[model samples]
Target: MDDLSKMGIDAARLPGWLRFVVVIVIVALAAGASLAAYRWYARPVTLSIAVGSLDGDAPRIVSALASRLAVNNAPVRLKLVETGGPIESAAAFSSGKTDLAVVRGDVGDLSQAQAIVVLTEAVALLVAPPGSAISDIAGL
Candidate 1:
């Protein structure tokens, strides 16, 4: 048989099974590369977050998440908007100025707000300073 190399086909040197495997591998790599390129150019879903200065952790935490997503080529991203406080943040959200907000339930018109994460634990504790006159809610 004439050497296929003479025809400038290097893959023809491999055995039939090897040739099949090589083709499969090449196809898989091409598919993966195409997917990666598509993801790299894809527009991510951008979400605006309203965070308060008082709760500084909100911006820091969300920024970290957004960085991670960007590094991973994730489909979601957050844009942080710093507000004066929780109530102001909630107002921004309610007024359609932001898509998300870090807010306290007791501080705003939260009728339209949906809970995302509870940064602070809400627990009723009964305790006082060591030299206080009372030690419970009744002391108030």
Candidate 2:
């Protein structure tokens, strides 16, 4: 009591019950703030992805990936936006309809697109008749 008074706390002026209530209120407020912060930090971020393919494989693949991410509790999640094909997917991306997209390199407007991965590789082959004079690419 003497030390509190010397420190100018004036503990005697506050009722014991009132002091307990004040302490409880402070603790409750701190707990609430901690809960709010945890919820904010643990929230998952979802990004919309445009996917399409002639055989409908793109959408299926992306959907599976999204499901796996959710199941694994990943920090980043994907939302699939199905389109007709690569052209439509690219258009959706270009128009800001989707945050990401699975599109072919030669399709639509890709000026603002950045390559993240190569899904597939294609080789172009030029063949001629066996008796043709064209033996090489330059001879054609």
Candidate 3:
């Protein structure tokens, strides 16, 4: 009997099952790479963010978030429209001018538009004279 390795064409050289597994692995890897490339090169999503006037923290935070998104290849185009506070935000939302807003909770009733994401707290600075004292809530 001739040895399998000594034969010119030998089934023992590489098992049929092993060949099937290698082909499957190559196909899976190709599919995964195609999916990743599609996700990376997709068009940037457009998001309209309604914020207060170009003043302080709100604008700064929005800018930072936009920048970070851009860096991550998920570009965000911010369309900042000036408004008073939450009330204005609600109105802008109702009119469909903005997709999101930085608004105050105390801006009266918000029974119109649905809240997407709520930002908890915002720091406000009160600058007064050296000898000034805030006796009551009204003073602030």
Among all candidates shown, the one with the greatest TM-score: 2
- lDDT of the candidates, in the order given: 0.83, 0.92, 0.72
Cα lDDT tens digits, model 1, 50-104, are 8886747777877788789889977888887888878889889889999998777
RMSD of 1: 9.3
Q: Model 3, stretches more than 4 Å misplaced?
A: 1-41, 53-55, 75-77, 84-86, 121-140
Q: Is candidate 1 or candidate 3 better by lDDT?
A: 1
Model 1 regions lying over 4 Å from their true place: 1-42, 120-140
Where is the poorest 10-residue window by lDDT in model 3?
A: 105-114
* Local lDDT at 115 for model 1: 87
lDDT of 2 at 92: 95
What lDDT tens digits, residue by residue, belong to model 2 across residues 41-122? 9999999999999998888889999999999999999998988888999999999999999998899998898998787768
Counting clashing residue pairs in each candidate, in order, gives 0, 0, 0
Where is model 2 more than 4 Å wrong at Cα?
1-11, 123-140
Angstrom error of the Cα, residue 83, model 1: value is 1.1
Candidate 3, residue 60: the lDDT equals 73
Model 2 compared with the native: what TM-score? 0.78
Give the Å error, residue 38, model 1. 6.8
- Could you estimate the TM-score for every candidate? 0.56, 0.78, 0.46
